[model samples]
Target: MTSATRPYGTRERRRSIGSQGESRGGGEERTGPAASEGQEATAILERARAAVDPELRAAVDSLPRRMRRVARYHFGWEHADGTPAAENAGKAIRPALVLAAATALGGPAARAAAVRAAAAVELVHNFTLLHDDVMDRDTTRRHRATAWTVFGDADAILAGDALQARALGMLAEDPHPAAAAAAARLAACVVELCEGQGTDTALEKRAPAEVTLDEVLVMAEAKTGALIGCACAVGALYAGAAPEDVDALDAFGREAGLAFQLIDDVIGIWGDPGHTGKPAGADLAARKKSLPVAAALASGTPAAGELAELYARPHVPEDPDDLDRTALAVERAGGRAWAQDQAADRMSRAMDELARAIPDPESAGGLLSLAEFVTRRST
Candidate 1:
């Protein structure tokens, strides 16, 4: 379907979806519960991470010594001197989604059943991060030097490859009745993720005018959504849930992942350096064809023309003010507004799919809260 005809494109439909959590009888707002319950859901995520971290560490430790050192350092588990560090690792959102999906469908027992799937997803997630840091020439991640910057580029790439292999190996060796199916699904997701990354790199080589909003959206789905969707599906598969339910959870994760990426792109350009752990207007400085940039260029507004002219220059804008101006131009060209609307629309659709998967909205509290957390600016 065209963007204009999509369920989330129209303001009226957007408003209707926004009110889905309200009390139909008295018009009472459900926002309060959603916020409180989102905290509860976040707590659940922490618990899942606690349960999965040891296994994750063990998986990393199983690699060859050199690879293990690089992986451990990348995971913030060790310092450059090979000593342990107290630094935090990733947010562990993908694995948390897996455990949450399983819990939502089959409770605590299902969480246990899905633990291997959770670990596998987390591994795949970090694998992507390692490769992404190299491809983007990113110097810092988690407020420290990226693996490729500290170690050699080849080692970083090898570590990422090993992680990907380990992820599939974990699933392949799983004793769960659904292991084979889960592994197959995850393998397909990896392929899609690669395709997405390829498309993203190809778009960067093109002039802004040559890209389309649809093309960017498709890339976002492939790059971010595919793995997230796979994470959720893996959980359902471990529980032996019906195929329809598995598909519903997958759809929900895909939508939530898109929303997450939309906001992430915004943060990439305009978020506080202290909070985001990156320079201000990082995306603009890199001339990366993020969603906001694509939307602005496609707007055909005068501001878009100005922004395009700025980007076409040979050197990236080194002056902070110039980068700020470029960011403002993007906003004025309607890119910011478009991306925010798309994130909201995706969140609404995600909730719809969650409802379909779980049937009882109240019973899906953890899933609902997690979904809300993904879309919100503040966690």
Candidate 2:
């Protein structure tokens, strides 16, 4: 990209970020919560969302009427009753990665050309969210009632299936040379994601001590890393990058995605309801074996033993107030710190992979900023 349109300055921006994204106050537009996180990264996400929305909306509009309504409501484009509502669609991070990856390797023209591919990726992501909410029994998403709760499980599920089909169909109709390969990779990602979700569900059913850290991490990579990797690889393909560079971008995205999942699991436990759109300590209440909990269980500390006992309790209606002890146990077992360290390490690996793909710091700044933005999400 030209200097006039570049998201970052000449200096490298891949610095250490903690549980929150570093905010340098770069005259950013402050579009929303996403904007509040970081200047350059949020701007890239906002622009990518803007570019992809029309295509996404058009694709949704093509669905059958009831399905269209569900899609619109889930995407936060309309109320459950079908009236216009404020947009609560997510920050568009995945799609932004697509555009940023393309721009890094090719330029603005590549980014522009990849908009359809970006929208396709976002569709696949939302499809998974819709299904995940149902399986996880999650009531909230994007700070609103999840589709399964608002519309019913059957409707929400059918809508999710439709969305997945729509994603592939969108790509099938595209004339871009890269479109076919992108579709194939995305389809394969869905398979891996399903297996990952399956593993997560199975783990939750077992005794806390029965699950291993490696098992959870593997599931996380499949469930989260696969799609993010596909998004970046798709963008690289659109950019006409060499095969090795495309693979490097895929690796970069997978590492960053694992970090994203680590932070998300952290938020699942300790997040503020106002920001996370879910009740605090919800994961603990559910006794879900998140990465932090898994680490704590494996720590062999006295607190780890306490956490194991807490998790072994049978399922009951959750009282959020009852989780303080459990959360404290996990923290005392060093779960929180371990997850944070692992997240930072994963991001370091991500930066390395990114450097392999785009060696010039100037060309790489956009991707680096985004990787930090994802990992740095704070509760």
Candidate 3:
């Protein structure tokens, strides 16, 4: 395969800049070449999470007692026993994107103004995760039993609903001048997310051969891209950026989110269970119409036919050999290759969109670094 066509693990691509400092705030600055882009992105995200977590916690705490406990546990803030645990929480990528976009458009001060928007995005993201776990019948997340598995389906769903309401409530109650527009944008994004999910569930009922790449990509963009875009746009809105600039940032986030989802699909099939917090071949076992599987099924290659036959089996494969065969079939059908190409292409296009918003490439270094981290991270 050519450089652009090669799969994710094949080679490294140098596409963006890196950071050197722990703070994006006023601090000792090193201008020259610094840490790896991945490390910088991680540092930036850590900082963003630290800045946003308090506000996020406050929002979650505002829920009813039962819902709050489930939300707290789901957020890795407490154990099932109602005890505090030093457990892994989500990466907070959505909130980080919001903050980074704000800083990119205005400055570090802009992040403070946009914090509510950041918190709202994070809440909505977790809400989706809670509902998604139930819908997918996923038993585990973040290396622990999913909320639905531990709290029962009704509570889990109710908790998710509470988070969604809280997210919109935050935006609605914000004193920021753009709060109304932000709320409207977020509400629309939720609608798109639901429609995308409906499409996904519908796809699951159809024969694999009947699904098209376009359909899957559209679904992925809606389910994943919409919120990320909204997060970025809200940040720009909070910063008082022009509508065109907001639109550009939204486009940037949408493209990056699409790339992120594509890589996630790849990880779903091939990632280490220990690292990914899921079983090997979990998406395949569920027969999920993930981006890679859809690509493979639509490839029209001989391997595609065999893959379809495997998927057409009466039940999900239980034998290790059968599961292995299914994975191999996806790769042989060119699904893996197609997804990798699309991810890279989307990342490149995301850069283009960022450029449209922030003319100076240096101004967008933080956002670019985050985008690189999303599309290039190992897990």
Candidate 4:
């Protein structure tokens, strides 16, 4: 239903994140148990979450009845109660990047086009999530049944199509020249994302030992970093910033996106079920060729032998005992360590990009913190 008819809690959760989002300062150095002392990214993420508008609730509510069901499932609106609520909704990093770049360029918060641009970025993000679940054959997402699991893949795909259309519509109608430019960049990024996914799927067919770190990095940058960079650049453009300034923000966004994906790789391998909302070693069970798995296979470690066998198997193991065996094989192969190092390197680059992008220490502080936040998150 429409936002007016929806419960305040649902709207608030979808439109704006909870205050706990501000606590993301933990996980600075993931190796240690203790969290980081300083905070920068947490604040920016909080702001982004606050500014995020509930898309399915607002935009999808007006769709045809069949289309609405598809959209609602993706947003966790029509799902049964006691289902898992998403932790942090990914920090609203992309939208925040957009807004932060805008503020750095001296733009006011009242800029309507910038707000719409921010919302558009988030819609694209969720759209990707919907398709990702189906592609991965994932049963659960955000600790609940995935859209494809409940509504079927066809419906979920249609929902993604609708959200994508809405994103373009928002950008086209935007009053600001800069926002429009940024939206165009975002559209280009979507094309790049599709290309990267194609490459990634192709790479999976080849032996992991054949895939180099450089190739993996290329895929990661295109599939994940492009959109993130667009978020920052779009924010800057919306603020009427110069091209050079927007490019710098773009650099920051790309690095930050890489860092974000690297950490995701780690979580996919070793994250706790309670926190990750999935079974431990979930990625390994799925034979996902993520950054870590690719590296370990390239190393030709014994873990690689195990990984190879796991991939060659006719079917996924149904028994928990067999699944755990596969998990140990991946861990033994050095996938975990390799992924962690990649994440650290990506984080360093993200910080470097942020530092160089904005000269003013105060304005850059939030961006800097956001980079750190992406690196250290558990889920």
Best by lDDT: 2
Q: Per-residue lDDT tens digits of candidate 2, residues 239-336?
A: 99999999999998998999899888877787656666767787888898999999999999999998898888843555544588888898899998
Better of 3 and 4 by lDDT: 3
Ranking by lDDT: 2, 3, 1, 4
**Candidate 1: misplaced stretches above 4 Å?**
1-38, 314-318
- State in Å the error of residue 157, model 1: 1.3
Q: Candidate 1 — worst ten consecutive residues by lDDT sum?
A: 1-10
The TM-score of candidate 4 is 0.81
Q: Which regions of candidate 4 deviate over 4 angstroms?
A: 1-43, 54-56, 80-90, 110-113, 314-332
What CA root-mean-square deviation does each model show from the true structure? 5.2, 5.3, 6.4, 9.7
Clashing pairs in 1: none
Q: Which stretches of candidate 3 lie above 4 Å from their native place? A: 1-35, 314-318
What's the TM-score of each model vs. the native? Answer: 0.90, 0.90, 0.90, 0.81
Model 3: colliding residue pairs: none
Angstrom error at residue 142, model 2: 1.4
Candidate 1 lDDT by residue in tens digits, 237-277? 87788999999999989998998888788777766566557
lDDT of each: 0.81, 0.84, 0.83, 0.67
Per-residue lDDT for 303 in model 1? 99
Clashes of each: 0, 0, 0, 2
